[model samples]
Target: MSRTLVSALVYVLANGVGLLVASLVLGDSFTFTFKGFFVATLLLSVVEAVAGPAITKAAEDNVPALKGGIALIITFVGLLVTNFLVGGMHIAGISTWLIATLLVWIGALIAQIVLPRIPVKKAVQKARGKQPGKEG
Candidate 1:
């Protein structure tokens, strides 16, 4: 899969699962709704599509945390755009939006960490720019 497609799927799935589990555990009315969770997932996918590559590219080069932090801010801007696109941006003066964004970011990071360990076949690796004895 292209990096963008894989990133979007992983972001949405992980965010959805995280929200579902958190809702069950917290029993909070706000986070317990399907709409809330799905909206957050959608927002996360948008962020991943836009800023994920930059962050991963930065990570590949071991960029300083300061740069990584800036990448994260860009990620949030992407997330807000997604949210506004799907469901208007009304902050409601509540912390749930912030909390949801943080949760999704954590989930996305986990997905990023786990994806590289999935072990592609040699042929597939080569096609994706990996070589048998050399890392690309």
Candidate 2:
């Protein structure tokens, strides 16, 4: 896949994983219908993709000390945008919102960093196993 396409896919997948985790772990606190989940995930990905860089750059240019928290800020804004600007997700309260943001950030990290490597790792192992002198 092209880098841009892979990046987009990864972003959406990451958002979905994060929302899924939040819904599962937080239970009623973070609720969404199936359709809502789908819409919200897509909207969230778009929002983050657009706003994330701008937010990071703004913070870097203005509040450089806040640089480290930019990802969290982006996650929080994405969640807020997903909740209000659209009609899919229903974050119950403040706690749920914060936790959801954290979950999404962590989920995105896991998805981007760990998820893609899994298939590659498996493929490498399979290829090695088929080699002439390979063990295990």
Candidate 3:
């Protein structure tokens, strides 16, 4: 597999894990059926991959003060877009949208940080004919 494919897979896996963790943590307010979860995960991954950079750039240029908070904004927008575009996912019952946004942001942040440290990446590298212990 090419490096691009491996990178994309890693990103999708990270986002999927993030979404799963968020759903588990938030419980009823954020829920997804089995099919819904997969659909939502795919949609979220696409949205983040395509729109994330542009959104981050816009935020940096227009709202410098929001630099740190932009990730949360992007995550919230991604969730909303995924929910709107995919019928399987549902986000509801929150008194404020901030709670939902924060949950997703935190979950994604944790996943992105933690997933790379897991053996999954080593497995992927091994599958690609690369030695796990060697750094490129």
Candidate 4:
């Protein structure tokens, strides 16, 4: 696969994991159907992809203080966009929204760190296998 495709997949997976974590943590406050999860994941991934860089740029130019929070801002925006538009997913109350945002952000952050390394580990193991008398 191309780098872009791999990156896109990683991003989608991260968003999915994030959403799942948020839903699991928030319980009834953040609810989604079985199908709604996938829809929300895909939609959030698209929203983040489009908004991430734009928001980063805008923050850099307009609000320098927000530079460190670009990812969080993107996550919050993703939830907002995915909230009403995605049919099966529902987010209730201000507190739920705030907690969901933080949980999702943390989940995605962990995913981003961990997901890319899986392929890298497989590749390393495969490479080590090619050499004779090498121990992994």
Overall lDDT per candidate, in order of appearance: 0.57, 0.85, 0.79, 0.91
Higher TM-score: candidate 2 or 3? Answer: 2
lDDT string, candidate 3, 46-112, tens digits? 8877888998899889988989887787877888899898887778864535676776667767777
What is the C-alpha local distance difference test score of candidate 2?
Answer: 0.85
**Model 3: colliding residue pairs:** none
Which order, best to worst by lDDT? Answer: 4, 2, 3, 1
Best by lDDT: 4
Query: Which candidate would rank higher by TM-score, 1 or 3?
Result: 3
After the best TM-score superposition of candidate 4, give how far the Cα of residue 1 lies from its true spot, in angstroms. 0.8
RMSD (Å) of each candidate, 1 decimal: 9.0, 2.9, 4.7, 2.9
lDDT of 4 at 28: 98
- Candidate 4: which stretches are off by over 4 Å? 130-136
Poorly placed runs, candidate 1 (over 4 Å): 1-8, 18-40, 51-66, 88-94, 115-136
Model 4, span 4-90: residue lDDT tens: 999889989988999999999999999999999999999998988888899999999999999988888998998999987999999
lDDT per residue for candidate 2 within 37-119, as digits (tens), equals 98988998888889989999999999999999999999899889889866656889888888888988888788888777776
**Which clashing pairs does model 1 show?**
none
What range of 10 consecutive residues in model 1 has the weakest lDDT sum? 24-33
Top candidate (TM-score): 4
Q: Could you tell me which residue pairs clash in candidate 2?
A: none
